[model samples]
Structure formats: C-alpha cells, structure tokens
Target: MTIPTARTTAPFDAVLCDLDDVIRLFDATEVTRLERAAGLPVGSTAASAFGPGRGGPLVLGQLSKDAWAESTARGLADRVPAARARELAAAFARAPFRTDPEVVELLRAARARCPVWIVTNGTPWLDEDLATLDLDGLADGIVNSARLGVAKPDPGILLHAAGRAGAAPERCLFVDDRAANVEAAAALGMATVHFRTAADLRPALAPLLARPVPHPRR
Candidate 1:
C-alpha cells in the first residue's frame, strides 16, 4: 500500500522481471494439450474447483500444483484423476516467449545499460521455458516462487531476487503486466512499468532507459 519515492533522478542498478504474462506467453493452450493427452476435455474440471468463473487466480500461483490436482479431481466427479490432473498441470509448466522481436530486443538493449534478472512467482519451469526460447544468453539469474515458496506482492521474493542479482531492491527496475505486481515492486523502491505492450512501456521507461520513445498511453 506504500508508494515508492520516484523523486530520484538516478537510474536503478538492476531490473527484476516477472515471468508469466510479462516475460512469457500464457494461454489456455495447455488445457487443450491436456485434453488430447488425457482423451477428455479437462478444463471444466479444473475450472469448477477454483470456485467457478476463475482462471488466472486459480492457475498463476494462486493454486498450488498439488491443490490444482486435488481440486480438479473433485470437480470432475472422478472423471479426471488427481494424478492425471497434476500431470496435465505439470505438462503446462512452460509457455513460450512471445515472438515480439521489439520486446526481446528492448530487453537486450535495457540490460546493456543495467543488469536484468527474472524475478517471478513460478516453479523451476521458468528456466525450462527460457531454455525453450533459447534465451540463456539473455538472462543473468532467476528467482522462482517454487524455490522461495512465496509469490509476489510479498517483498520477500523481490528482495531475495534483487540480492541474488547483485542489486539492491531500491535500485532495481521492474516490469510486469499485473498492476498488483507492479505496485508491489514499486513499494520496494524499484521503478515499475506495467507492460500492456512493448510500445506502452517506452514512456514509463524513457527517462530510465536511454532510448527514443513515442509517448505511451499509461
């Protein structure tokens, strides 16, 4: 709930990035994949157990991998086994990076000016996804929620990621698609950009990143 002081003109020393919906692509692609693999459309089962009409909250760190499995089984009336649901969820562990070349290029360009580390609410699967995108060269280090057992909006994970990235929390610039995550990072004294699109971030990052940018819609 605390707002960060952005009165400082100096640039932050590091960038802590979020993974899902911020750095990588996420969709219901896995639901179909699990359906084909399991010989049934298992989406509804997972949907019902998460208190109905909920997707993002149930999927992204809100429901643990185990909770997802168990809840899914109960929802499907034994049509989908907990073990199989877990397998399906695990299979969905990675989503490919968006093919937005500008985003990728901008990340590279930004990192040259300052160190960039991925600070995400995720399992070890983030490494696998980055590997899938062949971006080992792009990243310096990663902070995963599964390893830390805490998700963002919690300053602990942010501080931990920043510390490991050789940057202070106050000196890190963070990018995330979620407003809550952005606010959380900002509370820790990191500059935040709510990335709606690559173009939308330019204005927020213009002063911090040395680049020509068209004014973005906040």
Candidate 2:
C-alpha cells in the first residue's frame, strides 16, 4: 500500500527510527517518580528495572499487556506488590499511546527521503496507536518490539528491523534517544544517531536522508 508521506530534503537509504522519547513525550522524570512510588531500590529506573539483577530482559510481545506488566514488576519488585504491577505499567503505557503532530511531520519528511521503518518498544495495544498514526504509507514497514518478541539493545530485535527495511544493518541509519540502544545498533554495523531533540538530529541525519544533498559529496 502507498503510505502517505510528506516531502522533505532529508537524505538516507532506509530510516529505522524509534518512537518513545524520539516522537512522543516520554518523561524520564515521571518514570522515576513511579519507580520510587513502587518502592524500587535507589537508582532503580524503568530501563534499569530489567537490568541483570532481574530477569534476563523484559520482553514485551505485541498484544500482550502482561509482558509490559511483568517487566514493570521485575523493575520494582521490592516496591511493587504483584497486585499493583499491571496498574503501574498501564500508567507509563499511556505516554506513547498518542502521537505528536509535529513529530509526525518530521517523520513524514524523513519518510519522503526514503523508506521509513519504526522500531519501538511498546505493548500490544501499540498497533492501534500505530494504525491511528497510519503505518502503511508512513512507513515502508514496522518492527515494533511487541510484535517481534524482543526489545531494543538485543541484536535479534535490531536485526529483525533491518530485515523489514530491506536494508542491510550497515546501510540503515538508526535514531533513538537512548545511548545504549544507539550503541547497540552501531555494534550491528548500522549507523546511529542519539536523539537529543529534533534540531539535534538534523546534522547527524542530513547525510543519511534521501533529500537533495545540501552540498555535493566532496
């Protein structure tokens, strides 16, 4: 299907982008507060919740809210009783449950430059949000963690996305706000850009996007 996309001058072959902090309003501060309320040990945060001490990795399969809840439980085991795990998970789940128009526009611009592929870590319900955002034309394809049974930083998940984009790991450029995920992609031979803000992304992405090269290759 022809996915709808806005035109832009970004340069690239294939775009494998992330959703959370990159497109939506994901508040680390809020996650920290929830972690504290749940009674996790000091310095225990959402991402770190699934760190080594807990389970191997918090895998969230598409459509399984239970996976999200379990990951939350593992992260805050000391503070969160089993009964409250799902509820707490639901709260954070609401963040990326919606889309930002401005971010969507940026994605459109990027999409126009080349095939756009989304690879985000979210629950099963995220498909609804992705559809609401219109996946078909907006992305050449998608590789959400929920559907793939793996989350970021895992080579399998990254490789899974690389296959969907039809681009070798080295040819696809990955953009994620997390340093670790970006580093992980780099390890797989894909170029990566750590997203600090939309503006911060331009310089790093300019050369990789499909938009008219601002200057001829030297």
Candidate 3:
C-alpha cells in the first residue's frame, strides 16, 4: 500500500526503531508444544530462558545462541530430564518469527524522508532472523546490542544509533515496544513512540513524512 504524503516539513531527521514486537513477532507454538510434551506449563520454558541470569549474556554478546539454548536447558534440568529440557530449549530458541507489514510500511515511508535505523537489544544472529523475514532491506542501518556489547536503556547504544543515522538525539524519533527503552530514548533527547501496535506508529511518524512548502521568493 502506498503511504500518504503531506506538505509540512518532517520534524525528525531520522527514525530509530526496535525489532522484536515493533516489527518482528514470534510464534511460540513450538515452545508450547514442547512444554506440553514435557508436562511443564506453557510459560515454563520462557520463564527459565528469559528470567534473570539467563538472557542477559546472550543479548549482551557474551554468549552464543547455542550456548544460551544450552543454558536454558540447564535452567530446566530440575523440572525435566536433560534430553527433554534440551529439546524444549531448542524449540524456544528457534521459534518462528514474522514481520509486522504495517509497521514495515510506515518505516519505509519514513525512510524516504530520513534514515531509519533498527536499534534493537538482540542476539548475534539477529541479521539472520531479519534475512529470514526479508526485513533486512527496510533499515538504512542496524544497531544490534549483541554486536555492540550494549543494550537498550544504555545511553551509549542510543547515542551510537543516532550517530549512525547522522542525526542528533533531539532530531531522532525512537520507537520501541518497551517502555523502559522509550523512556531511555526520551532521556537522551529523542522523541519516542512507546509502540504497542501499528496504530501507534502511524501518528508518531506522520510528522516525519510531512514536507514544508517552499517560501515564495522575497
């Protein structure tokens, strides 16, 4: 679908966007199935994997995705047998993900006027995941925390992203599904969109798609 245009000048110089939940969504069916087969609760595996002490290293570039999966299996050892726990962890790690087309389109529209950068707290394999969803082309630049050894809410990464987009913090519009991330961007002088749905993106990006009319010659 074609994005609508406006005459007023865009407010921001660049767009800083998140990946998970903002544009990419995961299907946890495999994780659920594995949990059920192991006689564990549906959220049990997720709790073990994402709970404190587990996901941090993986997202911070300290651990590989395989190592994280193994760590998740270890986290489940007390509740299930070793082999079953490994299976469950593998399922959760490989959960299928898809992009939000509406959000993608909005970002695409915004990109026409200014750079759109993906600034996400993600694992090292994030590029592969983006390629799988065919979303690698959408962003002009990507700031993956794992690659940079930093994550959201850290002033360094956000500043780094704004710099990558060639925009100052105050002239950037940062969008993320997490409130803490949005709050961090705001603290850094960026305009933020606490993204919950595609609807949240449209209005926040509207000003960035607007073009100011040229002044008549004096």
Q: Which regions of candidate 2 are displaced past 4 Å?
A: 1-11, 27-63, 66-90, 95-97, 132-137, 208-218
Cα error of candidate 3 at position 67, Å? 0.8
TM-scores of all predicted structures? 0.66, 0.66, 0.88
Quick one: best lDDT, which candidate? 3
Candidate 3 weakest ten by summed lDDT: 209-218
Q: Give lDDT per model, in order.
A: 0.65, 0.66, 0.87
RMSD of each: 8.3, 8.0, 6.9
In model 1, state the lDDT of residue 69: 53
Instruction: Find the candidate with the highest TM-score and give its number.
Output: 3
- lDDT tens digits by residue: candidate 1, 74-189: 55546667777655555443223464566666666666666778777665344555665745445577777766767777788888888887878888888888899889888888
* TM-score for candidate 3, residues paired by index: 0.88
Model 3 steric clash pairs: 7-211, 8-210, 8-211, 8-212, 9-211, 9-212
Q: Write the per-residue lDDT of candidate 3 for residues 1-218, one digit (tens) a residue.
A: 99889643568888999989889999998889888888998899989887778777778988788988999999999999999999999998998889889998888777767788999889988877777777645889789999999998898999999999988999999999999989989998999999999999899887766654333312
Model 1, residue 74: C-alpha shift (Å): 3.6
